[model samples]
Target: MDFSENFLHYVWRFRSFDSAELKTAASENLKIIHQGFLNANAGPDFSNAKIQLDGTIWVGNVEIHIKSSDWLKHHHQIDDAYNSVVLHVVYENDVPIKRKDGTTLPVLELKNRISTELITRYERLFLTLTDFPCINQIREVDQLVVDAVLSRTLVERFEQKTGAVIEMLNNLNGNWDETFYRFLARNFGFKVNAFPFEAFAKAVPQQIYAKHKDNPLLIEALVFGASGFLNDEFTEAYPKQLKAEFQFLQKKYNIKPIDATMWKFMRMRPQNFPTLRLAQFAALIIKANHLFSKIMAITDVSKLRMLFEGLPVNDYWKTHYHFKKQAAAVSIQFGKTSINNVLLNTVALFLFAYGKHTATQSYINSAIKLLETLPAEQNAIIERFTGAGVKIDNAFGSQGVLQLKKQYCDEKKCLSCGVGVKILRSSSNHH
Candidate 1:
């Protein structure tokens, strides 16, 4: 009675409870020929079931509840949806259920039929307080099972991440280049400023970038100016020039700037400051015109990495983290890790998404291979999975683990996971 209805559903689906002498509450012999498909919607628990009640065959829906009295409690007897229910399955037969026409409905009680050991296994996995429901016993699961789950989760992660890409593509009227530009700009914000960066990209059209692609200063002016950073008065000559150039471009192109307050500076590395990132982004745009086309042509992972290397930004950015806020001159190279993060989050995602859209296997393979070639990402989620003895060698493994952790482990979908299924099925005694 303390257990969930899902446990009863699982027991019935697997026939884990005693079925040797199944009988209806009215003393008629009952035999389950087919235990209908489990329904997830707002209807019967199972549909299209087949049963033989006292040598008479019946085919219809089957409903499950914790108690027979719940039939009246939930008002299912009066609901037209329950009219087709051929059988009622409950954990406890507290009272007899009647159909709308007032005939007593056949009931199958599972309280006494299910084994205690199966209950213990379910409780161990679903009721525990561990970080992951099966963390304590995950290592004991077979290697093949673990690998299968990870592989499944990897593709699931790809599909899940690319869903947004596909939606954006639809909005862009199937323009792969423009969609790629917007998504890449969003990733350039990394995490903190992704939204504003995306908004900034959307505010200015790609044609304007193409018009001024040859002029790096104009590009930087457009980037910083449109980002609302050029509005402030600057002591430095470069920002002053950027402000003047942006004013010219803003009026000529009818471009609007996002609010400067949208950018965050507190508790962030100066190297990752939005100003530097904007400068790097402008350099990237100038360096790679028709970048999506170039990316599609490159099959090698290193060649893809070369595309983001050595972006040429103005020397002012090398000493300044903000407008007129000059720090000790630092080499303002976009670090390898940052480049790889772009490749992983942006390049690989586009490859996978474009492949899915165009029905090209090569692009899909390239996307997956890129992840496999990249070094493993360092994060708390990866650390926890590695701590649990999960063998993650590269970004592919780490990403898969991240998806598995968030989707299955965090949601406590133990009964639905392959690893959790294996663990629960290991119980030797079944009714």
Candidate 2:
């Protein structure tokens, strides 16, 4: 008799019940023609259910509860949304309920009809200690079911990413190029410096950089200066020259730089330093004129990777990770992993947003296709799933797994997850 409303939701969703002996509290035969859609937002538990009571067919919302007394507990008796509820389903029909119109409502109790095995399985799934309730049983789920879930989660992830992009687009006044520039700059910083990089990009608008885009050094100076990196004293000629150039540009453009302390360097690899990332971003800007247009035209993943790979930091950056610091001389080109991250996070999301904004299917398809071609991201969450025997072949699966973790597993919304439903319905023999 003790279970979550979500468990009841799952039962009603899949009709996991003995249909032959279904009857109301008053013993009237109840027939379920349709279970209806589960509503996540509000109003009803299930919408548009088709049910037959006695000899009359009813079509309306269906509300569920653990006990029929919950009808007054939730105050649905006074709320008008419950007025259309044709049938009330519950585990225990302890009391009679009425509609907002003061008419008696029929109730079907599930306590006698639901399998004991299903209840035991539900309790096990919902009361587990693992990060994912189904971690032990996920491997037992059908690969086809997993695939279907992953495919749906992938679309969910895309929609979530596209939603963020749309917000950025609105903030940028519907300028796709500006939105793309900000997103690209954020990815260039990766996780370590994304915040400062985003702040720096906003401080120095893309239009300002587009003016000096013809010259890579000027672009580098502008980016570094607006990032507040130029404010520090440097013993090297390269940084000193950059500082001098930025001073002139800053005054000419009336630019205000972000706080240098905002950029993080402690405990970060030299290759991922903000200075190095900014230089690479500058180089990318120099090479990729009308970047948004170029990205939209390219459909091949290899060519997309090639575009990022071709970016090379200035000669000064070849020997230096920072202004005063020097490291072994190596070409400061963006690594494959970094490029993949950019493509996955920035380029793909941008493509999706562009597709949605313009109603272009090709761009949306290109976004999905690009993720399919890329390798699966190596991260703690993906590794966790991998250790649990979940197969993730590419970024498509990786994105889906991320969505599943954040939206379903982490939130403990197991009843709404496909894998969770499968595990709960498989059997009650779980150890």
Candidate 3:
């Protein structure tokens, strides 16, 4: 099977070829002293490579390709960047190559040099349809390799999450409190109504809520009205009162509510309904005057839990799911799972983003510690990794596994992954 240039880079970077039998296409004995650093940007594939050809030691950039003719095909001959390329590596020596100065360039063919076992392992990984490309081989890989990769991937996942937070920060003009409020609003909606909740938060700016934050009733009215929940007539006294309050605030602030149809409730638990989430959000807003500051000051998880739990939903919501719909008097208190979800998605990410913005190591460390302290997330992706013999002890590992699966494994980027590299390097010995 024909492989990509990336595969060649992987082989060359790892020295996966038979070094003892190395020879150029023109019959010159060759030895690689150093493979050099792989270049991420344009120019050469590798730079500062040291290769001993015959008796002369050449030091310069190294370029690799599937075919020797790719040198001209890529128009590198006319480009001055290829002038320093001391060694040309190819899988197929299709044609002789000459530099811009009319001198024949030495070519090293890897077709016969690369181990068959390595090719097989690479093919197996790239061609597989499994949930994870390395699922079958993951069990055979060393635990140390898995640990190191997971550790790296955990940081990668945090950085990925940090990107979203950074963008939000940028949009909010570096307003940490506003950004955190928007993020919390989205998480409150969870997966089902996240978009609408986000829209509601954006529509009713944090400044508006800060004005009347002392009054929980007014806050709920604004939130519920801006969510389009108070648009319809209600038989319940609480709904009518909220509607009245919201109508007054809506005109004062010139605020617009999001489309009610955008909020989804099908197949979701009644406790997770959009109305209930909005009510809970208003309660949290009322209790935590400076929400972000209050969160940053506390390190205890129980205190954080209490901060979320102590703020009970309005009495109307305690026995109702929607405006007029009355359910059994089951308490609508924030459950442990919902609280943890906020901690994981909102609080932890807020800490990380704030730490990054302030360049404070302690907050960053706190963010990581918070993730480690939290329980692992329950989802299909984590379950698949567990089934594949990978141990996930906390949110850190689970988050890393999630990043690994989504970014690297799903994209078939095995060469860039530590676990994939380990598996490829060990395959030769196994065969």
By TM-score, highest first, what's the ranking?
3, 2, 1
The estimated TM-scores of all candidates read 0.89, 0.93, 0.93
Compute the lDDT for candidate 2. 0.86
Provide the lDDT at 71 for model 1. Answer: 92
List candidate 2 stretches off by more than 4 Å: 100-102, 232-236, 428-431
116-167 per-residue lDDT for model 1 (tens digits): 8888888888888775888778888887788788878988999998899989
Q: lDDT by residue for model 3 over 1-431, one digit each (tens)?
A: 65789999998998888777688889998989999999999999999999999989999999999999999899999999999998999999999999889988999998887888889889888888775998898999877889789989987788788899999889989888888889999999898888999999998988888899778889989888999988898887888999999999999999999899999989878878887888888888888866998989987644666788867578888788887787887657778889988988888888877888789987788888888888999999999889989988888788889889889988889899998898888865532
Q: Candidate 3 — which residues are off by over 4 angstroms?
A: 300-302, 429-431
- Candidate 2 lDDT by residue in tens digits, 91-197: 88899998878788999888877888888777777677666877877899988888789988988888877888899889888888888998888888888788999
Query: Which candidate would rank higher by TM-score, 1 or 3?
Result: 3
lDDT of 2 at 72: 92
Report how far residue 316 has shifted in candidate 2, in Å. Answer: 1.5
* Worst lDDT 10-window in candidate 2: 422-431
Ranking by lDDT: 1, 3, 2
Which candidate number maximizes lDDT?
Answer: 1
